[model samples]
Target chain A: MTNQHQEPLSAMLDDELTNNELTQALDSIKDNQQSVQTFGRYALIGDVLRKEQELVSDDSFANSIQAAIADIELPMVDQLETENVASIAKHPKWYQRASQKVVQLSEHKLLKGSAQFAIAASVALVAVVGVSNMNPGQDKITSPVLNPVPLVQGLSPVSLSSDSFKEKPTANQVTQSRINALMADHNQQLRATDDKEELEKEDKKIEQ
Target chain B: MRILFLLITCFVYSTSAAATGTATATASTKVVAPESEQLQSKEQQVQSEPQPQSEAQPQQATTPNGEKINAAYWLKKLQEALTKSNFEAGIVTLKGEKTESYQWTHGFKVNDDGTEVEIERVSPLIGNGITAIRKNQTLSFFESNKEPYSISGVSIRNFIPAIFYKDFGDLVDSYQFVLVSKSQIAGRSAQLIRVESVTKEAYNFWVWIDVISGLPLRMAYIDEQGEVVEQVLMTHLSYLTEPNEEINKLFEIQLPQVANTAIAMNQQTNNWQLEYTPNGFELLKSDRHHVSINREVADYYLFSDGLVEYSVYVQRPIESFNSPLVLKDGGTSFVMVHADGFDVTVVGMLPTETAFKIAKSVKSK
Candidate 1:
């Protein structure tokens, strides 16, 4: 449900809310994600109205909030629908640019990490291996390179570390990736076979 | 009132390591006795031609004390004694610079109709190890964020000395076990057995078995460079032939409810026809699954010298790491290779050379 606090948020944004109502909204927003997001949106709305997105300078606060919400799943991007992405001619491309930027920024947390991107690129690797295997005389160097820029991958499950990732020697990287791929495959199969976790409940007959 | 917001990563179930608990046994470790035999006839037999089917399960060999026990009997007995004998051992696992200390206990009781199956527990004496309680077929893991659930298996956790679960005779295809040396381990009569690869060029393993109890006291995986890559050493040992009242009471226990889901059926494996596997090695399991991309299915094949198990993985094109890589961590080693768009890797408790050889042996057929 949409909050009825739009008026109160506007009042707070205008510095016109009563001390008591302002205190209540501030307190309530702390316990609710939607309310906090609403406050952020209200702040953004204030920025646009003041016609000073640069001067408002909520970037640091937004960054901290982004970090805090990094673990939470975000909404999907509807802006990248094929037609919109395919459009070569659209005047005042403000929406397209804004949506694309948002997608680039949030893809890490909202979608699976660069592993997802790697899968998309590696389909070409499949063709490369298949074609080369069939024809010994085929030019090995003719294989296409899908991902030239290696994406940053995190060690721990936090933010992708700021360090730039360099794709190692193609042979070595493929071999290591093969090891990881197989090990992960082994575990996934094992999990498929044995990984059901269920809660223990009372009043049910269970054999020892 | 002033507001104070505490931000915490509230994902309680992130770590899925089935609680690996370890405890140290109280028996003192003793000095190794002497070399019974090392580089020997076992390798010769592996290199020899046919007509050895009769001598395959040889049991004529005797220890210094005139006790008749060959590699097969000793290995089978070791597995049986571990599960049947009521005992506890303090274990220390070493891999490179890291060491983990833990204790493992096994016990059982007999009632009217059937014997109360062996009850076992492995707990780490230090650090946050998963504590596992095994009563009969149920293994329940108790650890943080891991909702207690039971799975039916001989071992819920991996650190059970590998030799305790395998048959050396079965390993005759990949490894040759010969009487190597006598080592006093855990203040007991310990016999060292050299398990060499049939290929002669791959990694070898040494096992120290308690002479009296017939239990494996220690296992060491030796690399081609003559360095100990990984090892599980028993520092203390104790065995109970007969159950006492206190032990019986302990056996009468309650365990977590087993999960209601269907047990994981074994997945199908790819029979990647590799030509050059060392003798004594057997195909343990095979499974095929997608790696990064579902369309690019990868083949995983497990090969075992009975005790030391390794997996050979093969997948093709679609961008993966390209160069040869070797990694050694804890008790496992990994070797990788990329060629002709096919990426292959071998991982197990073997030396880097052994894994490297295995990885290189993967032919497209």
Candidate 2:
């Protein structure tokens, strides 16, 4: 009922009380019915408080507070870097540092690209050899593998254009453009397939 | 080999979403209107029939013998029955992924302003007791969580009696009501009514009212596909003589010092029109809410006919937004759909199909 007993009682209810305080509160509750009822009320209040705190907090209390501060700090930091980068880019020296960072990020991708090319070349060599070894009746099986020759030929011209954009475009703008293009191309492919299926269905119905 | 690997990856990704209840396997199922020629013929037949008002009015308002019953006569009778009744019941609400169950007893008391304060003792299935005491212009939620939070400028006075009876006169401007059919609920005969939106943007609701007692037994919201999205039912009812003092005292108790901080930085606002709501559904009131931290402009729209009440929330967008689930229990499915910079979440005990339909119909302005 009083603040002295209630402080430890409330903390004990929240499981935040030190061992000594918890023992004292428990002893007090056992001795007096009023303290027992008060403790029950305190426990209920603590449970509700914990639930509400859980609802509002995105992560752990410490993590969420840190995250909120980081969020506030991040934009200011980015803005400072942008202004510095702009001024440095206008000068000849700082451009080198920026270019170096960009190169480091793309280094693994460049290595992966070369490895893919090597794999594709080996597959093509095997396909050509297999086609030569096959009997006359198996020509139909090799015909589909030969179709990728045209697609591989088409990639060279687009990669050349992409290389130019990669050199000059800002990272954010490049990312946004890439996302837009990928979404647009996917939508186009879906439309084409839908149209093809509709036409095929109509033709099948006509035959029936 | 690469194609096989890609196919396996795609299968895994698709199945994972289906397992979590986040994505539906049948989402891509196209709704094809059964050959437009048939629909056009049906439309012509519908247009040729007598006006809905002329056909529906006589059958609904009148008894089996066909005598006109004025709206005022039914409304008064409903008010009297609700005021006189002493009721205690257990209610449960399940909205996508959340369920809240509570037992409550309802009683009326006259305030200083002469308006009645319908006091409800809400003992939650989990956590402390909640006393919701509402009089004209004031709505207070006294929870064990903290100090009592009070909101003024209330339009609706009572939660139960207002929603129990169809008092549509106050809500005529906001909704259009149609008596759908007669159905049985909780072993009693009831009238089913459909409340649809007059405005294109609002959601619609269907409610079942007990015929003899004029009490609401069940309520459902219909989705765009004409499916019930969510439903809440009031099942067992009994009358209690002694007020549950333990529950009442829970409301009177003030919040402890440690829990003085805010649960949410700002009150969330829900803005949408309601179409085809029952006769009793009224826009009881509106209030401006201010918060200490992350303060933003917001409004709360409270609606009740005489019994059932729901709060419509509207607020400014929060960065890195997460949808709030008030409660989740049972097999009820709750869903939050985000599109065009607006997030609409539907929570109720309705079927998943119904919840999905309502979620899809919410269009961001």
Candidate 3:
């Protein structure tokens, strides 16, 4: 029923409606509460696109919207639909109520467009930072420097102190990095050796 | 009468250990008194005699006329206490200038089907550090923000040396056992047993076993000059009759499965050979693989003299460190030497001089 009046309602906000059409749109909006809300939303969208004001009103904007959604009287809507379905034989009240719920849920969240915009902004920022940090020349020089192994590493509580020593920039980065790598590998080798020993013992037990 | 009683007890405990599959009683028979051989069946009856479970029992048994008892007996008791007792201990490991505290707990529980479960844990007393837990044969490590990993081993090699869990007879070839004077630790009387290296190449290990509970109270690595290079002291110990509530809760925790894909025994013929190894030190394994931390290929060799083990790594010559760079943390010495065509590094709980000698001995085949 509102589809016939949808054009005049939009044209009225765009200032392209004739005098007669504007008066009819005002009358329809005054009669229908849904039309009044649609008109207010259209006007806000127009103002935002034209750079009239900020999109979010306050810090608790999302919170307030969530609270409003929570306060919606779901039971009252269910009771009204059941009563309508019992009396009227035209459209099924259950279908109408289900459609109304979907509309209300989407309208109250107001997340579709805003979430996309946030994601786009983050992606662009990451691109800028990543491009700034990339150094292809340094990577080529350092890739050939392989770590020398340290044979046994006893992973202990005191190992943290040695780890901190590696964080400091030394005159020989290559040597220091190699030593760190070897020391860590040494501890790993010890654990692996223990593992191998355990497996062999198990195998011997099976043989016995 | 006292000697007869001691002999009967040792015979019973050794046979029970063998029967329970805890420790092999192969060398145990050799260490027992000759008279214990005849008292084997008689000792089985003494098991029900409410075997002296008092704190004053061991001290009374070991003093004066008890001098005939060997260190192997005390070591056997130590192994039994470690595996069978339900106790919690506060441990502090002194290494170099640092001291790390840990909460050590062990529980031996028996299932309804006659199967036994051994749960042991060593967790740092302070900061978020690696916490080791051993359930049966699986030794697991739980670290902060990292996946807990499990390796197959009978004991958690933390403050306590791994040798303590194994057969003490294995060290008979390389080390001599000596019974020292009685010492007090944490208000409890302890029996000191000193294990000296035969060749004097490895550090001497001294352990003080709690006379009553048979648990280790203090263990130290003593140098040639009788100076303690590193030590693990039991700050306090609580001997429990059954697993505590915490250990019972831990019993229900399903540990991660032991990963079978750990660096397998990849025996490869290495081109480098160690020309001079200390007496009794034999190569345990050798392989050429990419190191876990730095994907660098290295010819690695692990050597052990039963009590102590060391690793040798030979890699392609890199930027050398002042010919031989030697560093020591407690009893462990890290020695890196620049060789003819390759760089060699020797790391283990051995003396610096010994480590350096081993590092320099690496020669190309």
Q: Rank by DockQ, descending?
A: 3, 1, 2
Best by TM-score: 3
DockQ winner, 1 or 3 = 3
lDDT of 2 at A168: 28
Instruction: Score candidate 1 by TM-score against the native.
Output: 0.52
DockQ of each: 0.09, 0.01, 0.14
**Runs off by more than 4 Å, candidate 1:** A1-208, B1-77, B112-114, B155-157, B161-163, B241-250, B256-272, B290-297, B316-320, B363-365
Report, for every candidate in turn, its global Cα lDDT versus the true structure.
0.52, 0.40, 0.64
**In each prediction, how many residue pairs overlap at the backbone (N, C-alpha, C within less than 3 A)?**
45, 43, 4
Q: Chain A only: list TM-scores of all candidates.
A: 0.27, 0.24, 0.29
Task: Report the lDDT tens digits of candidate 3 across residue range B234-353.
Answer: 988866545667688778889999887845545774787789899878887888878766677888888877677888989887763555756667887777778998889888889888
- Model 1, global lDDT: 0.52
- The alpha-carbon deviation from the true structure for residue B107 of candidate 1, after best TM-score superposition, in angstroms, is 0.9
Ranking by lDDT: 3, 1, 2
- Model 2 chain B, poorest ten-residue lDDT window? B22-31
Please give the fraction of native interface contacts (Cα pairs under 8 Å between A and B) kept by each candidate.
0.18, 0.00, 0.25
